[model samples]
Target chain A: MSQTVKKTFRCHPEPDECKGCGRCVSACPKKLLKLGSALNIMGVPYAEYSGEGCVGCGACFYTCPEPGAITIYEITPEA
Target chain B: MAEVVKFGRPKGFFETFERRPGSIKKNMSYCPGCGHGVLHKLIAEAMADFGIQDKTTFISPVGCSVFAYYYFDCFGLQVPHGRSAAAATGLTRANPDSIVIGYQGDGDLAAIGFNAFMQAANRGENYCVFFVNNAIYGMTGGQMAPTSLLGQKTATSPYGRNALTEGYPLKISEMVSQLESPVYVERVALTTPANIMKARKAVRKAIQINMEKKGFAFVEVLSGCPVNLKMKPADMDKFIDENMTKYFPLGVYKDVTAEREPVVRPVPTFEKADVEKALYRELPGGDQEHESCDSEIFNRELRIKIGGFGGQGVLSLGLIMAAMGKYRNLNVSWLPSYGPEMRGGTANCAVIVNKGPIGSPIVDSNCDLLVVLNRPSLDKYLPELGENGVLMYDSSTIKEVPAVKPGQKAIALNTGDIAEEFGNLKCANAVMLGAIGAMLTKHYLTPADAAKFQETAEAAIAECFAGKDKIVKMNIEACKLGFDKMQAAL
Candidate 1:
């Protein structure tokens, strides 16, 4: 077996770009995505990341219809 | 911490949508949860992955996807409503190596452009079609479409779709699979992640077939219209899975890609000599020597308006004058306006002649010369004459000669009585042409050119009535008689 390593994945939501239809909320397996109460410049509440526990399955990236709305990334800790 | 991009915007799309014409260039104009955006993302990703972005041509239909060109970085053509398939055929044939894609909705493909789509599929054009069926018109309000489910309540079908009236939903995939030309046909949905994966694969396959030039490929995407259907995104997905899939029955209806070879259409030739030979079998004649008119009066543009009742040959008179200008190597344009009736209707034509390039053919006002064969035409067009313009009227038909402006000259000719004396009342237009010839020689043309005006008029008549020797001879004689009488009057 290989050594255990800390895993980190994150979902970055562009507030101004998201139309906030809540599609990504349902698409997230870890339930780490939600719509914020505060509206963006488009007058609709945009989706936000929970700031933790993002497995980065990319479900929310595909589910979010708007281009450039949800971008997923992987983070590596400094050695 | 080090960041590694997992999933971001595809490189197939422009870094910023500069063509969208709005402040938000990062987002598309589709409504929230619109299926077009999802499909666009899938296609854009596939384009970037396949490296066909440079050769791919997306034909956008006239529905919500009309602005599709504003998003994709590939070559895009926004065709008229329901004409994407037709345009795709031409694009694919003209450039056989191009990867052509047609994006259409239910109304655009099934309702309006169904035949065009089917004919292209039948001919096996090398392209891919992504048909988005949302059961209702998304752009033009939630009107029921050909693919709308039975008992579905829409804006047009308020009482719900009735089987007896609205007809059943069209099974486009089933119908397209029945054709022999299409190499691949599948129906997929975008409700769940698994289903969306299937749709994504289907999209890639369709585009791959197109890239390989393996004949026509069609994928009918059963999508949702959340806003139009007045449902939330989750409820819309449930509605599509529970209600739509039962009717649509998602699966591959046909796949003959393994048996078919890559399609190869003949490339079109564009050689100048070949094109000329194909368009015209034989050249008419060597260029005729054209004499240039050098009169000082001909230096400026001459706008002439001719008006008369139908059967009075008003348009023919304008044609003769324009022909006179053409034979002398001058710029000329003729615009004819008339009612539907061939007789007893108001007919008028505007003829413009200039030594230089002419601007507009419309002579609504400020005409340099006004010719009227009837009283009503005289009354209607007299006010349009310019300050120093000339007015020519047939006095035989127009008994009351209206007073002219101070700088204007009115030459009233009894051409109607002259034609009657010439034994043919139908020759009155020819007599009027002769009167115009006399007027031009007196005022506009130089003496040297004036002597050739009669020859020009005769040649114009012969060219107008090329094969009719009898009519041409009669008109020429009548023109001579009218010219002598008008010269005497002048």
Candidate 2:
């Protein structure tokens, strides 16, 4: 039952549109999103993704209220 | 895991509502990451899930929820502040097919609209009521709401909410749950992701109850006021989690869905014939509408003020004019001052007869005619009359008739004397109405006997005293006497 599943995702945190509400970081079930040290234009700490273990749940996208805050893309393994 | 897929915006939202020209998607009126946006999305999704989108009627009143009309893709009504619940009852009762969703704020539902909310809930209205409790009055600035937390500082409560002075905060969800009619009642929050999920469930269940036709359902969403609370967007949830939740506990207050039978809404078809049948209390065509005697006067747009003491039927006179306007099928409005001096105090109202829809009902300044029953009212209101305005005074009470400018008419009627002659001093205002009728129709003798104008006026007056035979006859006699005097003077 030990299978190494290599799945990746891209969490696009649109910097300009994000209100830095951190809803994305809190909603990510995979714990891949973290608040980066850098600040967006609004001077709030923007969320950054680790690009690992996204699981493609879209929880971050679902919970975000700010438009264009997060977009997730699923990665497929090469056959 | 399933592939992560996302749509641009909810299909239930109007594209224009979600965005403006050259703007990003989700151009909501609410602030960034406000609770309203999340709630709006939840409601829209519920409408879609239940297949009630086509039949949904979103009712939003004043407060932050006022802009909900622009958000919901379905039919929306922006009603008077705090009237969402009241209007929801009417809409659901009449249509029966539509799913009425009433969205209200704490200031609206708990404060000014509390009566309507209670009445609607007590009657087990067939609708879903969403009450957004942000603690503070968000739309009108961070003012104290009925649900504002104790020791919470707001614009009005600079020293924080003093429990002794402002009284204990109202537990409205618990209070509303005490009512015996509602089938479901729940309190939820929307600050965190887990809370948002719970709120989504609560929102869905509220709508689900309506879709089941299981009677009234209320969902109180403990939302945040980031801008008003002056908290950062992300920290508002933390603030609510720490401060607001301590006072307003989130839970299901009542759920009797399994015990109650589904509501059977009686849909009465509204047609001209149906209204006529109900109005006449008989078959349609049994009665005839009042035919116009003087089309010019009847059709003219006129603003008339009737002023006197409270008990003197100053308000009633304006109402009679409004009734006449209805008979003529002209749009009309009667706005009463409802001043403090009720019985002995000065009371007045403005009655506007218009060809089209009325704008503001307030008539503090301009008036085409001033009919004053007492000297005090006459003196106070005469100077404010518009140019070329007609002045009609009660000669029985007013000793001196004020001089009017050229091109203006002054009619003095001994209304008290005429009403006393008819064996009722209470009918003085009725007499004034008759004089006004005579002035307009140009007929004064036995105006009640005339089959056209005078009889029409009498019929309109009789409506005011529908059940009381004594008052109706006395008012008719008083009107005839006043009409004769005015006709003779002319």
Candidate 3:
């Protein structure tokens, strides 16, 4: 028998690196990304995460054109 | 607790793009949602994962992706428009262990550099070529490219590309797969998530083949040009899937990678001696640069002009004189000017000998010695003689004797008559050379140099006709006869 483990997958989008093409918003399977209304340093709307429903499929990471615009993280909880 | 980065920038890319200009080097200069950025990311990932980043070299084409060197961590080379494939072939041949990748656009590869790319492919160069087909030319303000669809409208094709005029779109993957040399050929699109996954796989597979040293792998990527096509990011994908894919299908056209062996070409030699041998440089005499001259005439700058008909050997006579200067340990320059005809036309040459360095090979004016073989040459070049210049003429060809200036001396020799009497009429230039030797001994050269003039003339004749024993002997006899005749006349 295996014990249940809790894990957290985070989608981190760098606002300064993002060109706000909205590709990640469409690529997300959970529909948790949005083109933010507030402008970033680039003076354009940047992609934002809903901070809840990231499954870490890496669709957003692959869709974003900029090299370091988006990154996915996997965090495992301790027993 | 454990934390890991599931997806991030590949290590193949620089930690910071130092090659890129300006402060904000984190992002590429490509437009937002550009297909080149996506492809760059895929290639960077493949380069890192395959562990060929250090050994890999990327040839950037002349398009929007010309700045690929700014992003790649490994070696990067920028080639002229559409010449990346040719440059990649050289890089691969020079360094067989290194991986070469040629990045090109539709305008560059298909339109401008099609022949170079095709020849490299046919030769089975050990390199992977990534051909990006974005329907239209994206770099030069959306011009119509060879891969552009018939109905597609571009800057040059304003009225929507006509089937009668623009022709059908080129299926590069299909064309490349037809060639037997290419080991792998695939057409992948950057449209849907599934399609992008396929493209990612194709990119990795091509680079893998390069790592294995497979011969000629080609991947035609159906990319998007959102800004140039005036479409949004999401719509661009739909356009490529629906419209472009109809013309250029997305699939693997050929995959003989499993059956093919690694290519092994002969390594090129870079040794200095080997290179000099390959260039056909004479290896016997090392350096003949001498500082001092034994002759007084060689101590100052001496400009000699020899003019005649083409068949009179005027140029060869100038060469012999220049060779004499070379033997005397002086700097010499020979400049030959001739008409288009090989024979019967005018020919002239200037031989300049100097103790110091020669400023120019041209002897347009202020000639110290003028040797004319024909009447026309004598009449044309007489005025160019400087003060106290020696004017020598073949009296057999010229009827009238030219009047000499206050200090100048005019010497006449029956060069043609002497050449015929000696052996062959073609040796008239040799007779003239002997006469020139006799005149220098009497007037210009010192006693010690005068004694060596005959030996120098014989040596110059031997050098000019090297390996031709009969011609060397006959010309030396002809030179001695003309020398004896000139000494008696003087």
Candidate 4:
């Protein structure tokens, strides 16, 4: 059987659209996400991906109902 | 004993009294008579009393108590309203040594947080939940909450809540106590001195149990909201005595201490090999097969809608149908529309079964099959069905409705009457499920697959009627009757 490679992904939050609702924080299966002080172009507090021991369950990506607020993609070996 | 010689005061002598070394010390912004303040104080006092202040972690909700981190002298996380239980579950599961407290209000606990609360309780996570029942939405300015008593007026209920119109208040404490996983479940009040004493004892016992690393523990506190109720301090006691106590009586609903000795969870060791072995043991092949199958099915989609009254088992029926589709190796998804409108109003659920990966679970406009339980549900969703879709309804209640557009197939079944003839009113949902099963099984499942569906339905029936086999028999008959009716109609 081939081993399934485990990968890590970082979710970037658009501060302009974030209401600091903490929906992503609650939906994260790994609990590695937190609200950061850094403001985005819209001056709102965006979600900071801690990426500390993330399981990559994509629970946050699936449960987040906000459109264009949460952008998630894989962090390749080069990056 | 000899007198101890003291040098200059120790460097950390005042540190003990200053504040919890790791906890929060900020003053909270909760209003007076708001249960959140009292609950915060009780939780903080519990942590201090147990000497776990530094190790305690508090999970805050979104309502008036959203600023729970302000008062607690410990690590705190301000989470979304109604999701504190879920967050605390995650935190406690990851760091089992830390004392996790989930603090939530009536609106957050009973309204939008129902699924999270139920799933957590069902899992029996090692966390203490302090449910503060204020009956009205305080943060949102007196909106009707799930715990709002019948005939009670709120911002949304200008006229008193009518049972026939608005439905009854949800008894969450009693509901949670019914689950088998909870180690302790109790309801206490802070209205009077006697009640407050009981509440303190309950809170203390809950904290002590947490310190012992026990399983799930819950305490529902019947609290007051003077600002929301618009009641004077002097009238608060009378209001609670006359109004609140009638709906939320305080008592211990479940305590399993006498039944068995406490089971201690093994301290987790940090070993990559152990983690890998345990992960593989728990999830052997992973869920890749299930995911890939669902993706394949989603790649050819079909949308189906099922509607009925609140207690007619519409949601479960829809789930069973979706589960059957999954068992037959089809892609399936189910979503239930529930809330206040479900009590006296029509209830419905949407299921999307496909051959490939599906796009959305929510049914917005187009649907293939519309199963209506009542006239109102039919009237509400009839137009949303596509021109080629089939519409089915319970004929017992619905007599007349607006004309259906051409190209849509409409069929009515006397489901309630059929269930009554079978001597059970609850089996109408089973009948509808059987009907839907007969129609969809040919393409997605087999006769054996339908039997598997019936086996599950029967097991659920038997469990629901543990001591009453007659009821189970009647429900089975009802299922058969509905299946035969659909066969004849088709």
Candidate 5:
């Protein structure tokens, strides 16, 4: 419904620690993250996300549960 | 877009998970990101939200559920493995106004306690059953459970379970739904945030229904066991999402509260008179019969010694004395001593009855009365009898009458022959008790004490052989024989 809205934020996921649990994939309100084929250093799958439609509301990060799995960061526009 | 991160742990949990040196209390026994931790938070939050903490009586069964008592800041009853629902059933019935929560794990509920859970649900018992079905046994090493997947490999099922031999996983929520009693039934998972929210609703609803006095409400939680699943914490959640969900679809299976009415069980009575009616049938009062003149002769505590061969009703005689004292509202105690060999060894018991509270129950040396049915008992306890103490023996078993001390009273009767006339040798012990009862009357005691024990002796004999009318009649007749024989000697 808000396709015309400008992009708001970015996501910071610790790739090495991600166990590819895909909790954010199910918890993401904007449907930006997915459990992709990319494997981390531990040989476990990991979730991938894009900044195009990312609102960075932190639902994905909040529901991740596993510590150090992912982090949410704001993408501020230039002043 | 300046995103602000605002999130914190649930309020019911402790501030920090760190354990300092020599910390006495541990927060919880849950693994990181485990479904049990989330479920515990959800349940505690729901309990707090409903304002039922004061009324909650949590029943935590074996397995990991046993650790729930450490988390909930409320009254809890830790039950044996597979008996959570049964204990909850009793608690809810006894205190209909209280909220009872039965918390169980898969091995506890679905497997070992399947019958108990099924009975509680089928009866539509008023309680909330929160069954956590985490595929495999978590507390013990990974083992095949009632809800284990067909191809799941566990410690017990080293090779993956085969449908041909191991059978399919039990669908408990679905099975419970078929019953018409439960007002609510639902199966929810803890795989994702959305599912967890749904699970929260189900858990809250079940407790809410229980608070409303509704019938049984069950919530089956499809949890994850990452340790046994051979996966990381998050991956286990994904396993539940990908595999467990397909086997156990999440949804509400029943909601019949609209058509159903609340059940109200009658509260029980607490009056002492009611207790009397239930137990002894009548409050004990001084009987008019057997009134004696010298009931006040003896004013001190009555310490009695009754001894005989084993299996000769020595314990029964002492028990009758204690029961009579107890029934008459007197403090009483019966301490028995018997040799190792049950049938042939000497057996004896001491009976102490006081009008007031008793201090020490032992009468090691000084005894007010002694009744010995055999020579060995007489030889063992004769010299121990205090001055003025009465000694009654069955002469049929003793060949000679021993010399009695000057102040003490001694009476011997053919008790075995009297019992033989009554058609049973077992009545011989009853005869000795009768003589002791007769001596306690005006013959040897203060008039008040004699009167206090008068009507009680026959009544005690009657109550001792209760429901065995024939034996009671014979024992009473044998007792009267011993009484008349001892009375003539005096």
Candidate 6:
């Protein structure tokens, strides 16, 4: 079989105001985001992207209410 | 006649065009003419159309539409009534990359779960909360709900609900729109073709906004509960628009931004020692000592009940006790039944603390200790006390003595009178808590544990009283009195 194409989407959180309320994880159509082990400036859990099968639909970025808390980017084959 | 012709499948058919890989292929469990079915269908179609079905996480609530998991192809959670918002908050926060939809009914949204719902909106938690408003409580046999329209009658309201006595129906869409954090708030009805089209547009726009990761978005659909409304399916549109729409108006309430951001939260990996040092703290006792106490207490179970006047701290006491149980490393659960009983003039709560996981949060009958703050509570639940159970009550107001079953121990103390003497009438609950702690010493909880519980109780009470110090002090003393009395009785 041909090499399976895989894409990775990630969310970056702002350390100051992420309250750790997990709305983005539930809002993603790809089910790729989750609360990461890292703590923000306020010491709350922030969203983390771990799954490799991201469609880049921007659902997580759109559904996240915290500005600059969630950053979505796609990882292509070369990366 | 023109010749009939069929076109062949287009190129890249599997890759470019297909039904959403995540949507389930099954009929919904909603009733005929129920707006939930239509709304679910619309959402599924939208997800499929957008090719993001595999990424959605649907949060379902208790109501006529509780079985939403069976219909959605994505991961689904059937949450408790009014808790879908909180659950969605957890699920979405845990999986910010998934499409989360919090679905609930009017009773679930407006009455029981309003606080969580409002908090989520105020914080602008990213997700779409679709509230289905069908004037009456359809799943609970057409009871009058917070959103039940004035002048409408239901099981509880024999006559039409009077605005003067029952209060006007809550406009949830309007209420949610008033919050600053929410980016989009709209009310749409599924009554007629025109209204359906409007609702479809609103749904699409809300979903699109959610996809954009802008802010909190909500859509309230004024749906028809034909069976509960005593109307036929054919007349649902007329009934909803004429009666329901008049009470719950339809329109877009708020939309903050046009542009969207990419949603992503950063991940931090931590060492085991760092995690332990960060979460664990030194309390009154040393860390090792406390750890051993935790293990020992975690192996024991305790059930305590609190009953008193409506204004008394019955529910608060139960919560504090539950908190103490948690502090002791035991599994804890607290439940209260106070609406009609308290309104009819009484208050009560059941708290279960166990070493292992609890089977049910609700108690049908029998408890380890019955703490009665008033005569009615004593009379009502006194018989349900388990054999060898201890009964504690305030001696001040309870003048008439009712005969008890043999071998049941009843201790009467002037808790309310003592609380009044202590200068805080609300301390009656604290007194009961102290008595419970003293009586259940065999369960391995200490006076310090009880005091810690009291502190939590005081904090909650302060919030309720808007930070009143005198009330907190009085309740604290009442707790002391109960502890002292329980010692004397034991």
Per-prediction DockQ, in order? 0.56, 0.25, 0.70, 0.01, 0.18, 0.01
Q: What share of the true interface contacts does each candidate keep?
A: 0.73, 0.21, 0.75, 0.00, 0.17, 0.00
Interface RMSD of each: 1.0, 4.0, 1.1, 24.1, 5.4, 19.6
Q: Write the per-residue lDDT of candidate 1 for residues B14-90, one digit (tens) a residue.
A: 88999988698889989898888888998999999999999999988988889988899999998998998889989
User: How well does candidate 6 match the true structure in TM-score terms?
Assistant: 0.47
C-alpha positional error of residue B224 in candidate 2 after TM-score superposition, expressed in Å: 1.7
> Highest lDDT, which number?
1
Q: What is the clash tally of candidate 6?
A: 36
The lDDT of model 2 is 0.78
Query: Is candidate 1 or 2 superior in TM-score?
Result: 1
Give candidate 6's chain B TM-score: 0.53
Tens digits of per-residue lDDT for model 6, B1-490: 1211111111101221123233322223445346665576566656666766677778878898787666565677888889988987776677776778888898999989999999988877778988899888998899998888888889887798889998999998898888877888899876654566677677777777777777688999888777788875447667777877777778888877565464455433367876655544333221234323343444645566788777777888777777655555455688887866543367778888785668787754667778887788888888778776777777888876656678777777777876787667767777777776566563445655544554554444444455677765666667668778767866
After superposition, the stretches of candidate 6 with alpha carbons farther than 4 Å from their true spots are A1-79, B1-26, B259-490
When sorted by TM-score, best at the front, the candidate numbers are 3, 1, 5, 2, 6, 4
Runs of candidate 3 with Cα error greater than 4 angstroms are: A1-8, A26-36, A50-57, B18-23, B50-59, B75-101, B112-128, B163-186, B201-218, B249-280, B283-490
Report, to 2 decimal places, the DockQ of model 1. Answer: 0.56
User: Per-residue lDDT of B348-440 in model 5, one digit per residue for the tens?
Assistant: 999887755566777667788888889999999998798988788888998788678999888777778877876889888877767776766
Q: Candidate 2 or 6, higher TM-score?
A: 2
Off by over 4 Å in 2: A1-16, A35-46, A56-59, A71-79, B1-8, B15-22, B283-490
Q: Any idea what lDDT model 1 has?
A: 0.89
Docking class of 5: incorrect
Chain A vs. true chain A, TM-score per model, equals: 0.90, 0.75, 0.89, 0.64, 0.78, 0.64
Candidate 2 or 4, higher DockQ? Answer: 2
The TM-score between candidate 1 and the true structure equals: 0.70
Candidate 3 backbone collisions, by pair: none
Please write out the lDDT profile of model 3 over residues B176-261, one tens digit for every residue.
Answer: 88999999999998866778889899999998898888899999998988999999999998899898988898899999999999
